[model samples]
Structures are given as C-alpha cells and as structure tokens.
Target: MSDKYTFLTQAPVHRVIGVMAIPTIISMLLTSMYNLVDTFFVGKINTQSTAAVGIVFSVMFFIQAFSFFFGNGSGNYISRQLGAQNTKDAEVMASTGLFYTLVFSLIVMLLGWFFLEPISILLGSTPTILPYTRQYLGISLLGTPFIMGTFCINNQMRFQGFTKYSVYGAISGSIINCLLDPVFIFGFSMGVSGAAVASVIGQICGFVILLIMSQKEGVIHYTHRRISFEGRFVKEIIAGGTPSISRQGLASVSTIALNSVAGNYGDAAIAAMSIVTRISMFIFSVIVGLGQGFQPMCGFCYGAKLYDRVKEGFWFSTKIGTFFLLFWSVVLIIFSGEVVSLFRDDPEVIAIGIQALRYQMIIFPACSFMMMANMMMQTCRKTIRANILAASRQGLFFIPLIFVLPYFYGLFGVEICQPVSDIISLIVTIPIVWSAFKEMR
Candidate 1:
C-alpha cells in the first residue's frame, strides 16, 4: 500500500479537499481561460465567424462526452480499487480505458471527417457560418484521439491522487494554446483554421505529458498486456462511466437544442448565447474543480467503509462550492453587460447575452449542491441514481423545456430554460442525496 494516499483516509476533510482542489481549480481555470481566448480571438473575426465557432461547440461537446465517459468510468473504478488495495485491477482499468478511448476516438474522427459538411449543418450552422465551421471542425476532428486520450489519462492520474501531475498536463496545454492562438490567427493569417490548429497542437502536448506522467512509479501504468476486451471489464467501465456519459452527452444534446432554438432569433442570437455559455462555464469551472477534488475522497472513503468521512467531505465541499459560486454569481450579475461585451460588441448580442447570463446566474449556487450530490453518487458507485440525476438537468428537463418554453415565450423562453431546469434539478437532487446518505448510514 502506498503511503501517499494515507491522507485521503485519515487527514482532516477540509485540508484533504483543499490540497486536492487547488491544483484542479487552477487547471480548470486555465482551461476555461484558453477557451475564452479562443472566443476572444475568434470574435475578432466577424459575428458570423463567432457564430460559426458557437455552432461547432456543440460538436466539440459531443466529442468531450465520450472522452469523459471513458475517463470517468475507468477513473471511478481505479479510485475504488486503489482504496480497496487492489492494485492489479486498478492497473487493468487504466489500460483498458486508454486503449478503448484511442480506438473509439479514432473511429469518431474518421466519421467526423467523412461527413464534415452534414455534421456542421446538423450543429445549427447557418449558410454564412457553414464555411468557417467546416474549416474549424475539419481540423479540430483530427485531434480527437489525442484529446480523448488526454482526458482519460488525466482522470486516471487524478483518481490515483496524483492531481499535481494532472494539473501540469492541463496547464501546459492551455498555455501553449493561448500562446499559439494569436500567432496562428493573425501572424500566420490562418483565421479560424489557425485557432483549430492551435487547439489540436495544445491537446497533443497535454496528451503527451499525461502519457509520460502515467508511467511513473506508484501511478497507474498503461501497458499492452493489461488491455482487456472481456465483457466483465467492459461492463464495469460502462457501469462506472455511464453517469459521465449521460451528463456530458446530455450537455451536447442540450447545446445543440439551444443552438437550434437560438438560431431562430438569428446568427447574432446564437453568437450571443454562445458567449453566455462560455462565460457561465468559466465561472462554473471553479465549482466543478472543487467537486472533482472531492470525488477521489468520496471513492476512497466509501471503499474503505469510512461513511462518516464520506458524508463529512460531501457537506464541506458543498458549502465551499456554494460560497464561491454565490460570490461569482453576484459578480456576474453586476457586470453582465460588460462581460458579454468582452466577447462581442454587437448591440443585439450584448442585449441578448446580458439577460441570458443573469438568468443563468440565478441558479448558479444551486449547482453546487446538484453537482456534489451527483459526484457523491457516482463515486460511491450508485450508478443508476447518479445517471438519473446526471441526465435530469440537461436531458430530461432542459431538452423538453427548450422545445416547449420557446413555443410559448419565444426568445425569453430560450434564455430562461437552463435556469429553470437547474432549479428543478436541484429540487430533485435533495431527495436523491438524502437517500444516498441514508444508505450510507
């Protein structure tokens, strides 16, 4: 047994969480910063070009869905195995996840390239935006394997309690991407294609870094011999991973739905909504990083049957996450227009985005509880309950609301759908979390 993980089971809950979360928070913030950088540079193009990136974002979310599926699925299992002192199973899970993610991502890349035009159209790109979308999406898909592989490797390292290493990979990639964004976009005159190329190269850097780090002693090591295609191993991955897949997959679906609905208002509306989504995600990343910091603890304590510690960590994380989100929500509300203007200066985009951003912020604090509940369930291996909670926010609620609300209220309906869904998901989360805690008791 490694002495490194002793703190997870014995250290004070708050201290353990702080140690794990700070690096993740930095990594998440940097990741969001580079994404904002992408929007910043791409916004310098035209509104149509900005809208094109918005349209392609749904496709990017789809790719991320699968990457997270494999990463979290195997990561969840690995964390518990390590907790139970089953190093052999942990290693197999690691290898299986990386191997399968590579194969599946390659297949997705091929399919994405083969049907690039239709895929772009399907993501709600208008005729004007279609050309830029193709240019960006075509190049972006080429890095699917690396992006997916990086995600898997990062997750495994994180679950193994090697969060600093994960941070190193992620921060390095974001720094590289940010540096290259301007050079490729302006210096080389590559435009949107330049941004896509920079992104791919950045992902490649992170992937390489993570791959090297994963091989270090006391971390999960990937080797050809550990790869397994057996049905049982695959089932375990699917069981553990389904929540992530459902959550991310629903996000992709909801984004597509959002883009399509917003498209009715015009390309400006789509662009405005895109900026709002990016900014909201940037703010929400802090909460997510905190939740992620709590996840390995949940897995380890649960596996070790330290139920009290699990519960303690959950509440502590929730309180901290809520406080930070509330603070940011106020900041965003106060400067909604200015924030929206930072991305694009169009009067119409600013008008649409300001209202949308405020509406989303109304429920930002609720997400702390919702996310912690989901993460707790997932880490504790309550797969079905986790999936239900995961799917509800975007899939069951947001999807229906997106279609239905727009019918009655039009643009306002579209803007408010997410906040409404978030509120209801929070309502649903209370009982689910309560029940899980009861089980632990």
Candidate 2:
C-alpha cells in the first residue's frame, strides 16, 4: 500500500487513532486489574502480605525496565524500518531483540531466585514483609523469560501497527490471571504465593499467544542461521530505548521510595498506598494506551520525513489523552475513599489512601501531556529530551521531593509529592515541546 492509502496515512486521524488505542487501552486496563488482583488477594492474607506484594512490585518494575529497554528500543527501530520499507532490517531488529530479552530474563530470573532475600530488601521490604515478598518474587521470577519475551513481541506487533493482536495477547493473559487469582489465593488458601503463581502462569500463556502471532505475521524470525549483530543498530536501539528505561527505571525507584516512606506510617499505610497505586495505574493505562497509538504514527511519519504529520500526531494524541485522563481524574478525586476501600475495608487504610489518591488525581491530566511528549520523542528518536523527561517524574524530581516533603509535612507531603513532581516535570517539558514543534515546522 502507498503511504496515502496506509492506515496511518489515509484514515481519519481521530477515528483511526481510537481504533488503534481502544484495544491497547483495554489491554492496559486489564493489566492494571491484575495488579489490583495482586493487592486484593494478598490483602486477604493480612496487611503484611499486602505490604509484601507492594515491595515485590518494585522489583518487578525493575525487571520490566530492562524488558522495556530492549522491547521498545528494538520496536522503535523496526517501526521506522517498516516505514522506510526495509522489511529485512525490521526482522533482524526483532530477532535480535527477542534474543537479548531471553538471555537477560534468564539471568534475572536466576538472580531473583537465588538472592530473594537481598532482592526483597533492596526493593524496600520491611523485615516483617520479607518472607511473603520472597515467595511472591520467587514465583514471579520463574516466568521472567516468558514475561520479557511477551513484552518484546508485543512491542514489535504494536510497531507494525498490529495493535489489536497485541491487545489479544495481553487480554488473554489478564483474563487467565483474573480467573485464577481467587482459586489460588482463597479457594486453595495459598495466599500471596498463589497470586504470584497465577501471574506466572498467565504470563506464560500470554507469551505463547504472542509467540505464535509473531511467527505467523513474519514479524520475528527464530532461525538457527546466525545473524551478525550490527553494533550501530544495537547502539541505536539502546539510545532509542533509553527514555523507556528511564521512565520505568525511575518508576521502580519511586515505588521503593514510596514504600519506604509509607512504611514509616505502618503496614496499613503501606497497604493503602499499594492499593492507591493500583487504582491510579488502572486509570493511567488509558493514557498509556493512547500514547502508544501515537507512537507508530509518529515513527512512520518521521521515517517518511512527513514532519507535519508527525507534529499533528503528537498534538492530537496529547489532546485525546488529556481529555480522557482529565475525566477519570475527576472521578477518582471524587471517589477516593470508595476506590481505596474496594481493596481493603480497614478504616485506617481508607483514610490514608483517600488523601494519596486525591493528590495523585490532581496530576493525572498534566501527566498525560508528558506521556504524549515522551512517546513522540521516542518515536522520532529524540533521545536526550525523552530520557530527561522520562527520568524526571520518578527519579530525580520525585525521589528527593518524596524524601524531603514527607519529613517536613508528614503524610500529607508524601501524598502530594508525586503530583508536585509531575507538574514540575511538565514545566521542564515545555522547551522540548517547543523545540520539536519548531524543528518539525
């Protein structure tokens, strides 16, 4: 198909974007629910179990950062190659990415299993939470390669503009996870460990689905024939992926910091914060879904040197994401207590979570802008600004704010730190946005 006839080119931008985004959004929402399921099941075991789930959550994010680093980096290159009509290059990139993800995930899985204690502690596990954390991490680690490979293939599919198929893989996993959670966690009385096991099984199933899809679509080749690694291509992938690494990596740090800060308030506070994070993430997934829809469009346009189209995609995505997030944020702020109480009914957990949720909601719409900007930059291979903005929200900007604000203002400060950091990050993004606009024009 000619550029003018392509889905990214000829279709009504808004309708086409929605067609691309809705499945991705549904997938994101389902994935978010699994995290909620983690909390819900673990919460039933006791608050400590819930807190343990929270600690292990950070460790999982750390693993995902690496996964995303390769998945996104490779996918970005492949998308551009496709746009440039270099099919062979796209396959090579996808193959190399899969190869790397498998190796990396195996090493991580072994390390997580062998050093569960230290790993849990590093992720901010309190001594009381360590046992549960270890069990949860151990189970999840067993499926690390599957999860990592799934993400890599899913990214490739999305880059190829096969967003619906990517959604199928994610939804299949999430539905299985949702179905198994109660059986494993309560029916068998397996507790936190069961929840982790359910997640592992779900990820493996999802991995199989994605693997089959990739092969049939010819997106990735699992050939025995050796493919020479192009040093420059690897470098490009790393460079392109740096933003995702920073975004997710800093998120891991933020999770640890948030847990440590909440720990000071007691296990109830930790549990409440964990629930709040899950709730907020469920909403944030919509923003991610829309941003992802914009990614391939931006990449393809940029690759084709259609700078105007790239600019249009960025702005249009930003508007759509902000509108949706704004509406959701309002609902969350209005129903903060109800949302928190859904996971755990404790009065103390509800009280702490309400405040956190309210503050987090205030920043949601603004943060959507940052998401759009970052995704656009990544797709266009604008690495430096992308990484800086990506790292800001979680790492440099939020970490110190979280630490210092909590000390001075108590629990309220801790709750407010994320929103504050988000606003500041958006401010920093303004210049990058302007520069991109000027360049594109």
Candidate 3:
C-alpha cells in the first residue's frame, strides 16, 4: 500500500477515514449519477415512462440487497481478517463472496426476465406505466449478473483498502452509462429498454475493468482455480454482512410497500412518488458514499483492536455526512417543486411529488443517523444489532407505517411514511451510538 492508503491498516483515525472516504464518496456520487442520467433521459419520454424507472427501482434494489448481503458481508469479514493478519481467510472470503454473488444474480435475472410482466405489475406498474416498466426491466434484468458482480468486486476492493481502484472502476462505468444513455434511449429510439441496455453495458464494462485491475493490483485474484465453499467462511461472511443485506433488502421491500400505497392514487401518484424518491436518493447517495468510505477504516480499526480509532472514525464520518446531507436537504426542500417538475411535467404528478419531496427533506437528516450507525456497527461486526436497525428504516417500521399511515392520512400519509420511519429509526439509533462510542472511547 502507498503511504496515502496506509490508513487502511495504521493511521490517525480522522486522516485514515478521510483518505478512505473521499474516493468512496466520489464513487457513490457517480453511482447515483447513473440513475440521475437515466432519469433525465427517461423523463423526456413522458411522466409515465419516467415513473416506470422509479417503479422498477424496488426490484433493482431487491437484487442489490441480496448482492450486498453477500458482498458486503464477505467484504466486512475479509477486512477484519486482513486486519487480524489472516490473509488466507481474507482470500477465502473474497472468492466465496464472488461466487455467491454470481450465483444469486443469475437466479434473479432468470426470475425477473421470465416474470417481467407480473413483477412489474407487482412493483407498482400502472396500466399506462406497464409498457415502459416492462421495457426497462427486461433489459435491466439481463444485466443483473454483471451489475451484481461488479458490486461484489467493488466492495471487495474497498474492504481490501484498494478504494482508488474501486473509484476508478465505478467512474468508468458511470461515464459509460452517461455517455450511452442518450445514444441508446434517443439515438436508437429504444426508450426504456435503451436505459436498461445502457445500464447493463456500463456494469459489464465496470466488472471487466475491476476484474482485470484486481488481478494486476494483487488486491484479489480471479483465477480458474476452483473456489471451495468453506462453511466457517460462509458463516462469518453472512453474520458480518447480514446487517447490510437487511438494510438494502428491507429497502427493496420498503420501496415495494411504498409503491403499493402510492398505487392507490392512480398512475399520477405512482409517477409523483417516483420522482420524489429519485430526488431524495440523489441527495442521500452522497451521505451513503461518505459512510461507505469510513467502512474500511472502521473495520481495520476494529480488527486491530484500536477502539479509540473506531470512535474517532465514527464521529468524523457522522459529522461530515450529517453536515453535507443537512445542506443538501435544505436545498432540496427550497426547490422541491422544481425538482419534482424536472422529472415529470404532469401538473398533478408534480403537485403530489412536491409534497412528497418536501416531507422526505424534512426527515432526510434523521435518516442519515441509522445509515451511518449501521455502517459503523456492521463494519465492526456488531451484526445482530446493526441488522435490526438496518431492517427498521424500511422493513419492520416502514411496512407497518406505510400500511397504517395511508389509512388515516390517505396520500399524504403514504408520502410521509418513509421519513417517519427514518425518524423512528434515528431515535432508536441513539442508544447504539452512546454505547458504541462509550465502549470505544
């Protein structure tokens, strides 16, 4: 490792976290840009088409949640092993995680491809939005393996403290996605399929680049040698990573629940909710990116038994993430209507979307706490607690809130559910923070 990246193993907590987080933040922002760029192109087609993109987000997140479960789970374990000077264990974790991701993604692709119509319908596809949803989902599903594999590879690299390479690979993919969006969507008149195709192509490019670079960089090996699944390795990976999986997996579930509620108001409501979600995600991605940057430092410090470093890393990451997100949420709140209108010009959709976005902005900062806390706890192997909190934001709390809230407040309730759950999760996270920091300090 270079002097700069030496923070992965040994460095002052603040500096180490900074070194690790910048690239991750860039990568995460770039990742979000892929979605935004696609949203921009899809928005040109009409409100229904734009909403189709949002409709399919839950399915994508579903696939991603599983991939994250294994990839992040394994990566977290591997990082700690490396920190503990268990290189072989780290290798095992890497190989096992990659294999698991490939297998899971292939299965998801098959299911999604075969049942595209029903799946889309189930994901909140209104009759007007069904065609666009199917078109985007069909092609996007085809790229599931590539997307999931690339995600796994990136996580592995980040955990191994090769974050610069991870950033480069992701940036390359984002650029390709951005460049291809206009070409496929407009130039070829493929519409939603065009967006899906562009996304897959980008993921493939990213996977290839990371695979080759990983070998050259000696970060991890992708060899013809058979990778045997060790039970212990799997257990360790699953335990450490389950929190991430629950966080993302539950997010997928939460999205579905959110869509179901939005569906009650008709296509316009679906479209409106979609725009609101995309806008919120655009802002939230930065916070997530920064938190991801701190993962390596947290894991390494925990592994090295540098408890003080862990506390310092957690505080710095939380402070910076909160500050950035607070500023963005304010901006989003101020121009909430404009932001919603950018995705769909339909008057009714924009009206609902503006309301949804405003509520989301109000709850945005509270949401950050659960996210950052989960990252810290999971990276340090406090899996069970992390998983509970991770599941809270979208799964446990969101499911009930979305269901019950809509009954009382109707559409407004549906729009406000996520932020409410986020607030609840944030409140719950306080004790986790106090105890974690107290112990570490």
Candidate 4:
C-alpha cells in the first residue's frame, strides 16, 4: 500500500475528516470572499453598479456549472481510482477533465462575446445597468477557460487528498483578486470593469499555480499525452459528473429566474438580493468545504469496500457541518442588518436584504444535512440519487417556487423562496440518504 493514502485507510475517522476538511473550508472561504469583495467595491460605485455585477453573476454561475460538471465528475472518479490503487486511470481522468473543461469554456467565451448585449438583457440587466454589465461580462468571459481550468485542477487536487495544493491555488487567486479590486475599481477608476479585470487576473494566477502543482511527480499529474477522448472515459466522466452538472446548471437557471423576478421591482431589489446571495454563499462555503473534505474520504472508503468507514465519515461530517452552520446562522441572524449594510448602506437595500438574509439563516442548518447527503451520494457514484438531490434545492424546488411565491406574497415571496426550498430539500434528502445507509448495511 502506498504511504500516500494509507492514512486515509487507517487514520481515525475524526482525524481523517479534520485533516482533509480544514484546508478545503479555508479554500472555500477565500473563494467566497472574492465574490463578497467584488460586491463590496462595486457596491461603493452605486446600486446600479452593484446590481450590474449581480446580473453578471448569472453568467458566472453558467461558467461554474460546466466547471463543476467536469471537476467533480473527474475528481470523484480519480479519488476512487487512487483508492483502488489505479494511478494510471486517475491521471487519464485528470487530463481528460482539464482538456474538456478548457475546450467547453472556450465555446462559452465565444458564445458569450457573440451575444454580449442580448446575454446581458437576458440576465436581467436594466437599461441603467447595461453598460456596466457589458464591461464586466465582456472582460469576465475572457477568463472563462482559466476559471474553469482552475476549478478542475483544484477539485482534482482535493480528490487526490492534496487539498493543501488546492488551497494554495484558490487562496492565491483570492488574494490577488482582493489586492487588485481596490486598485482597478477605484485607483484606476475602472468601476465594474475593474472588478472584472481583477477577477480574471486572479483566476489566471490560480490556474498557473494549479498547473504547476499538478506537475509534481507524486501528485496527480495532467499531461496532454494522457488526454483521451475515448468513449469509455467520456462516459465515465459524464456519469460521475452529472450530479454536479445538474446542481450547478440548475443554480444558474435559478439565479437567472431570481434576477428576472427581482428586476421587476427595481435595481435596489436586485442589488439587495444579490448582496444577500453573496453573503449567504460566504457562510455556506464552510458547509461546502466540509462536505468536500468528506468527499475523498467517502470515495476512497467506498472504493476500498470500507462501507462502514464511509458511513462513519458521513455522520461525522454531518455533525461538524451542522454545528458550524448553526453557529454561523446565529451570527448572521443577529447581524443581518449590519452585514447587509456593510456591502451597501442604502436604507432600502439594507431593509430588503436583512429580512431575506435572516430567512435564509433560519433554514441554514437544514442545508448542512442536504449538502452532506448529496456529497456522499456523489462521491459514492450513486448517480440517480445524487442527481435528484443535487437538482432538488435549486432546480426542482426553487425554480417553481421563484415563480409561484412571488405571485401570492409579492416581494416577500421572492425573499423567502430559497429557505422554503431548502427546508423541502431536507425532507427529500432524509429518505434518499436513509436508503443509501440501508444499502451500505
């Protein structure tokens, strides 16, 4: 047995999870901070600027949808391969994922530039927000290949249990983004365009670092030679990655729907909801990071036929994730107004955001469970169950709710839709997870 993952197969469950999860949590927090920072600096320009960034976020979601599709899909398979002592297949999967991600991202970038104006309009950009939206979206689309590649490399590293490498890439990029946001947004007077430039630079930086790290001898290396477009490899990648595709793809759809619905009210409504969404994601990153930490462990254990260990890791992650989310939910609930005001202090923005933020916080703990269950299912390659859970929160549940709730309750319905979806998702998750546990038994 290779010393690289003997610890995974032998270490105490708590220690294994902690060792894996902490770096991921930090990486995720840093990544989420970039979005918050962008929102903050852009918010200083005006509500329209902030709202413009929000509109462009739908595009960002689209980028991430495909990125995660490849990243998680390839990463899951690589982890299991490593667990089964198949390094050759793991390398092939890694290279294959990176190759396809770059290719698809290029397609998205071209398509985005081709329909830049129409895309902006479709994303819910108001007339006043269009110029800023165009500037941000145009520059951002240029970095799509780099952004997608970075995410793919990061996920590959994490699945190989080299999450520290993943952190190096993510944190380095976030730091660059943070440092440049002020420089470009105000120092150079680039406004929203500056924010986009800063973001692209940061993503490029991370992409370079990940590429370097992936080249190390013992780590999962990506090579052009290993890049195979063979049908079997492609099928496996899609099969393993379908859950992430559905999850992120639906998330993009939901964001677009939310933006369109919120746009009806005003830019303030869009900005308010946008700020709340970024803040909620910042808090939720901890849960996601923890869940990611659990992923390789689950993948490794399940691949090695250590079903009991997989179950143990799942429950352990659930508890830790629950506690962390509960704690943050309290903090967010208590300081909802202050938190929203930090991004945008306009009274209207703050008022609209605070209530929505609190509603999200109310059901935040439920998200921990749903997220954990989904991660476990995905890691174990429970495709159908995982895809169902992945699609439920944002796609299956939230999509319809976004349309229906706003009709009866007006703006408040829009505000509360996500939390309501989250609660229902939790209910849906329990049975699916229970069934999986029984199967493990």
Task: Identify the superior model by lDDT, candidate 1 or candidate 4.
Answer: 4
Q: Compared with the true structure, what per-residue lDDT tens digits does model 2 show for residues 303-389?
A: 878787777777788887888888988998898888788788789999999999898888788888899888888888889988988
Candidate 1, residues 352-412, lDDT tens digits: the string is 9999999999888889899889888988889999999989888879999999999999999
lDDT for 144 in candidate 3 is 88
lDDT of 4 at 129: 90
Name the runs in model 1 displaced over 4 angstroms. Answer: none
Task: Report the error of model 1 at residue 144, Å.
Answer: 0.4
In model 4, pairs of residues that clash are none
lDDT of each: 0.90, 0.83, 0.82, 0.91
Q: What lDDT does model 2 reach?
A: 0.83
Question: Distance (Å) between predicted and true CA of 418, model 3?
Answer: 1.5
For model 2, the superposed segments whose C-alpha errors exceed 4 Å read 1-5, 217-220, 224-226
**Considering every candidate listed, which one attains the maximal lDDT?**
4
Better of 2 and 4 by TM-score: 4
Off by over 4 Å in 4: none
Write down the worst ten-residue block by lDDT for model 1. 1-10
Compared to the true structure, candidate 1 yields what TM-score? 0.99
Which residue runs does candidate 3 get wrong by more than 4 Å?
1-6, 224-226, 438-441
TM-scores for candidates 1 onward, in order: 0.99, 0.97, 0.96, 0.98
